[model samples]
Every structure is written in structure tokens, then in C-alpha cells.
Target: MSAMTSAAPPAGARRGYPLIAAAPPLIAAVVTAAVSAAVWSRLPDRVATHVGGTGEPDGFAHPAVLVTVSVLLLAGWGAGGAWLAGTARVPARALYCGALAPAVLLGYLSPALLLANAAADQAADVRFPMWHLAVAAGAALAAAALALVLPTRPAPEGERGDGAAPRTSTLGLRPGERVVWQRTVHSWLLTALQGAMVIAAVLIAAVGGDTGAWIVLLGGAVILALTTRVRVSAGEFGLALRPALLGVPRLGVPLDRIAAAEVRPTSPLKDLGGWGYRITAGRRGFAVRSGDGLWLELTDGKQYVVVVDDARTAAALLNDLIARRSAHSEG
Candidate 1:
């Protein structure tokens, strides 16, 4: 574990689609129904006549279908956010963002409406705004990029008060054998995953299928897979990595950094704006579940964090890290 320092890693950007974070209950349904109705209204007389409505057709026989579809779509968004939120193991906060990226991307994209409009294209003279679609997707992509980018900083001074470890006469190398333990494979794998996800999204968009939602769904699956993690160590305060599909490492917040942690079963649209490590308007750190370990706050605001699966391992690791830090300072 590294010491908490003024040179700690910088935080990722906090921007995402609100629609995907926590879709407010009635609002999403109502909006879906309204959008459906508005789309229906825009059709030429011929198309509206063909749907075979009564004296007055309300989008469908009723708004039930629209509402149902809205719920399913919102569920998708919530799932994506939750999956991303689940991957916050210490040192892997970026992965958590990757996991929830699709949802964030699709949140403002209005997947349901776009698909429906595309399906109804022949019936209506009007078209859904391509501008809206582009903006939404672009915003999501930006958020995804922010979450995955690794935070790099010059190594902070060791507790012994120097930037490098103390000289050991023993490693058998001359006086100058530097060890650079950069995590190469791990970083590459994550970056490749992001590329794969981008490719998948592009393919869906090009398919010209019923809205480009297939891409979002595919991305969501990748994100979820990235979140499931295992404990790499056992025994003190906490240390574990929640994997991700970006060029970022796992979340590895020491439990000691957590000033407080709480869990709230939030609605897909009601809370948790976008994804990643979110500090709600009320200042609560939300991970998908307590089942997975989450270190919310840092004692010094300089440590990394993760949403890990093994709480005990995290606790033990944190303890060990603190001991090591203390030993160095005392020595």
C-alpha cells in the first residue's frame, strides 16, 4: 500500500447520464408514455389510420405497453449502474465506471424511444432527433473515458522521508538496480476490454437495427463481468482489487480511510447519478451491496478505493497496510 500523500492520484471526472443512474419511478414511466404519445401524434394520417385506433388511440390500446417497456428499460439502466458500482474494489475504481458505462451512455439516449421510433419510422413522417442521440452517447463515452484513465503521480516520499526505498546492500545488484513494478498485463487487458466495448457499440450503431440499444446491452454485460472480483489476499484492514474493463487498476481503499459507509437501495433514477464512486447530493457513498466490501471515505482523502467482494480480506489488508506505514515512520 502506498502512503496517503499530497501526491495522491487524481479523481476521475464526475459526469454521466442521469437517466441511467437512478431512474425515478413514476417519472420514467410517465416520460416514456409521453414520448410514445408524442411520437404517435407525429405520424401522417395514413400511418395513424393503419395502426387501427378507435375514435382516439392513446399510443397503444392504453399506456400500459409504454409503461412496461419503460420499466424494463429503466431496469436495464439500474442494472448497468449497479454492475459498475459493484466493481469498486480498492485501486479499481475505474473498473467500476467501466462496468456501469453502458447504462450511463444509454441513459439519456432514450433507448426505448429510439427503438420505438425506428420501428415506427414507416408509419410516421417525423423522426427522433439524431442530435439528442449523439449528444447522449457522447456524454456517456466521455464519462467512461474519465473513469478508466489511470491516475499517475510521482511516488510520494516513503514514511522514512525519501521518495525511494532505503538502500539495501543485499539485492546483489550494483548500487543502481532499479525495480519498476509497473502492472503491464493488467493494464493492457483492461484497455483492450474498453476497445472491445467501443467496437461493440459501433457495430450496434451501424447495424441500423431498432435503435442502437443492442450495443448498450452488450456493453452492460461486459461491464458486469468486469465487476465480479475475488480476494487476492487475506489476513488485516483491507486490500483487494475489483477488476474493470479499462486501463485502470482495482479499487483498494483502506478501511481506515472510510470515515463512514452506508448502503441505500436506491431507485435506478432516484439516486446515484451516472456511475463510478458517486457522492450523492446528500454525501452518501453507494455501492451496489454491502455483500461486496466498499471503503467510502479516506481518513486523509488521498488513498484509493474499491468495491470489493471480500470484506474480511479488505479489512485485514488495510490493517497490514497501516502497520507497514506506522513501522516505516517509527523506524
Candidate 2:
């Protein structure tokens, strides 16, 4: 990826939100309150609030309590949306949908709750309305459409730029020289954390008989196994990043696509926005930890950065390879 000499703009500079992007959640909150008020009287004192897999009411709660819960949930969602809109990484469209999703859910589910509880005197008479599901789905689609049409903030200035001039090769490769530099990186802390999570998931699935929990644990295990060790190499062919076990390259930057290479210090969370395989509009990164790394700028204006030890040697080798390729092309 292209590197920036200057630091990022202050968080305060990125805090504004577009009116269209901010309106949906507010509108949804108001509609939820209005609908709740309108149906407050028709709802029973205690409604069949939760249904089991067999389509029977398994739990009951007062309608007022449910409305209160919905209101609280909407409030929490609104606050979260406001916070998310201020962040640079998250897309406005995603924020809009996420913010309004709770309201849309409660809007249809509230009425459905009343319908399900209408014949509370006869428990067997209750049936969920498929129309309510359709209505909720339609509302969600409309919100998503609005989010798509809303204008988004421009990408930040200095997000990408030609980095500093290349340092001389540490490998001392002369013009037309070809050599390879390779290294493997691993993060013990991350691996341990993931392992702990997998164990917890396994235990929960065993005790609770949750097939979904078992699936989640298995997926985590697979990811942990794949990501524990990464193999990175730089040669005349360019740079390749792959999992050690898989041996198949997941990312490759050809000699021609690479404009420059540099070794630079980085913050995993602050710079790359947290660990492995991060993709944004302008750049992609494979960041395992906070430290120095080899950064590459491609001809197409995108960047790829990977955090690893021995970055100085790797950057030098990559630069030499790119220079050799360029000289050969000129001849």
C-alpha cells in the first residue's frame, strides 16, 4: 500500500455525518413509539411474548414491559449508530441499516406480539402472522435502499501517497542481481486467545446441546490453525504471503505492479485497524502485531502491507528486484 508521511487527521475532524445517513434511525425510533402508543390499549395485560420452535407460546410478559424493552433497545441502537457514524472505518450505509434494524424488527414484532396473544385465553389458538415477517422484511429493504442512495463523506486526505525514498539494499544486490528473502511470523497471544475461545465454545456446546455453538467452535478452530503462522517471501518474482500450513499464496504483488518498497513502523490497531487481512477502500493489510513491516505501493494505486520481523531486509530485497525488473524492461 502507499504510505503516508503525515499522521492521520484528528478524530474530531472526522465526526460529521450526512443528513440522509442520519435520518433513518431517528425516523424509525419515532415510528416505533407511535405504533406502540396506538396499540397500547389493545394489547393484553400479559402477552405471549416468546414462542418456542413448536409455534407455541413458551413465555409471557406484560405488553407495557415489552414496549419498554423495545424503547430501550432503540435508544441503545441510536447511540451506537451516532458513535459509529463518527468513525472513519465503518461505511455510512452499513451504519444506517444497523441503526434502524432494531426499530424495524420491533415495529413488526410488536404488532405480531399482540396478534399472537389475542387469543391468550386459548393457548392452542395462537399463530404467528407470516404477513408480519413480510412487512419487517420490506421495511428493512427500504432502509437499505435509502442507505445506498445517501451521499457518503469523502475519503480522508493523505490516505494514500508516495512514501519516502527507498533506502539502499541491505542485501547489497547490484543492478540485475536476483535474490530471495523469506520469514515466518507468529503471534502467540492471538493464538492463545483464539484457542481459549474455541475451548469455551466446545464446552458450551457440550453442556447446552447447541449445534450452532459446535459449528462456531469448529470454524474458530479452522481459522486459528490457518492463521497461527504466516510465511512471507520477497524475490525477483515479487512478494508472496501465505499461511505456513496451507503453503498456497493468498496475496501476491508482481514485480511490475510494485512501484516501491519501504520498511516502516506501524500500529496494528491505530494504523491497520486491528489484525489479520484488513481491507478498506484504499488499502489491504496483513497485520499480526504492532511493529515494523514491509510496505508496498502498487501501480494501480492500491497498497499491501504485512507486519513481520526482518522487514528491513525484505524491503531492501524487494526494491532491488523491482529495480532490476525496471532496468530489464527499459533495455
Candidate 3:
């Protein structure tokens, strides 16, 4: 049996972990609320929520509505970042900075809208100054800088000894034997989400919203094409992952580049910070749902993981192939 433990954080890299998860969004929410309240008396009933290419107001919403949406968006993103930081095998700095930059950008934008609309009689009269873009960009940059200086504790490495040992032995095969293993991994959550997005897009179009509806439709289509399900295959081409719907876009690792392969348990949320395709520090893979996964250790030192059932057979076949290739090269 093999055991896994965390390597200690590099000297001087370890520091006290603060409440960074809630800080950025909470502070941004407070700032937005304060700014909105201060400008309430001077603002028009409607605010320009969307601007066109020339900085003219093209879409409008009630001030209260805009503020509420902004706050929710900020909080939701921050929560996701925080959860990923805590559970996903990713760098904490990247997560914190990623979360803060968007929160700061939206925080500036929410107040900037109110200020732009202040003292205006109608939403159409509001002009979003190009300078506001520069300001928002600068604020996001500033937040990123702050994140760099803030103390961040490294994410804990996952322990491995608790589970059953992965299938590490190569499969016994007759000379000149050939075999192919294939499995389809599906995510019900992604399918449901895709349907919801399409329905929402249709609803928005029915209500006469053009830009937003098209955006939603495009998002749904992209999600469906890339993430609803993946077809995994291990054979002469080595391990591959391709969208079950359309096989054109494929992710593959050649046999020559794989140093080893094995079967291991994995979690979509805990290991990959939610589903779809994911890349972390030294690993990248397709994560549809959590279960047995084919873990490939590449020649370049990076790791690849793809969730699938019956990963043991895949791993055994891969190892046999690797051994055969090595023997052929030696011969």
C-alpha cells in the first residue's frame, strides 16, 4: 500500500490565512450600497445598465434592480472563488486575485452608473464616458495588486492512502493482441443547465430583448457542444477525450508522451473546482462528474485526469501498451 502526504510549504511562503474569501465581495457590496444611497436623491428612476459601442445607453433598468443584480453577481462569483480556493487543487493566489479583480471592476461600474445617471431626467440622456472604462480597468488592476501583497496560505495537498489502491499492474496480453476501451461520461447537471439557458434565451427573445437573448443562446450552444458529455477512449492513439455530441474538438495524449497511467478516485468539485474542462497548477483534464478517473502522468511531469467509470481496464491496457512500445523501441 502507498501513502500520500502534503509536502510542507516552501520557507517564507507560509503565512496566516485571512478571511480573504468574504472580504472583496463584502467590501464591494458595502461600497456599492453607500454610493447608491448617497446618489439616490439626484438619480433618475431608471439607470443605464447596458451601453453600446459608442457609449450610448441602449438598455435600462430601475436603479434598485441594477444595484441588486450587481450585488448578487459579485457575491456569487466571490463565493465560487472561495469554494474553489478551499477545495480545488489550485493556487490560492490565483483564486483570490481572480475573484477580487471582477468584484472590484463591478464595484466601480455599479457606482459609476449611478453617478453618470445622477441629475439626468431620462436614462437615454445618460452618456457613459469612455474615461469610466479606464477607471474600472485601473481599479481591477489595483485589486489584483492588492491580492499579490496579501498573505495567502497554500492549498492543502490531497491525501491518497485512504482509498483502495489503483490498478497499477499491466494487463496480460498475447503477442500482437489489440484492444480498445471506450466509455461515455455524462453530466446531468450540465444537460439541465443547457436546457434552462436555451429556454431562458427563448423567453428573453419572446419578451423583445435582442442582445441578451442572443448572448444567452450562444452561451447555451457553446456549453452543450463542449460539456454535456465526453467520450473517453484508450487504444492505439492512447487516451482521448472528445465531446460526445461533436467529436471534432478532441483532447488527446499520445502513448509516447505518457510515462504512466492508473485508475484513481476523483471529485469534480473538490478536485477540479466544478465541472467541464479544468486546468490547475500542474494538471488539466475533463471533469464531468466525480467517480473513478484515469490518471495519466505525462513525460513532461504534468498530470492529466478524466472522470470515467471502469477506469481500471483503461489503466491496465495503457500500461500494457506502454510496455510493448518500450520493448519494440529496445528491440
Per-model lDDT? 0.38, 0.64, 0.71
Winner on lDDT (2 vs 3): 3
Model 3, residue 242: what's the lDDT? 84
Q: Pick the candidate with the highest TM-score.
A: 3
Candidate 3: the clashing residue pairs are: none
Q: Write the per-residue lDDT of candidate 2 for residues 1-331, one digit (tens) a residue.
A: 2222323332312445533334555565566667767766655656666776666677665555455455544544564455444433456667666655655666567656665666455434566656666788888778667767777676556332235333333456776555777788887655654665566556545444346755886687778878768898888878888899998656778778988888655545555676677887777788766456578888998888887877777877777677777778899
Q: Write the per-residue lDDT of candidate 3 for residues 1-331, one digit (tens) a residue.
A: 1222213222112132224665687678778888888988887866788888788999986676566556655655655555444334456676568878988898888888888888577899998977888899998999899878877554335434345465465667556999888888885545654664565555545545557645867686677857668899998689988878788678879989998998766766665666778889888888765566688999999988887777777888888899888899999
lDDT assessment of candidate 1: 0.38
**Model 2: which residue pairs collide?**
1-303, 1-304
RMSD of each: 16.7, 10.6, 8.6
lDDT of 3 at 258: 92
Is 1 or 2 the stronger prediction by TM-score? Answer: 2
Q: What lDDT score is found at residue 16 in candidate 3? A: 25
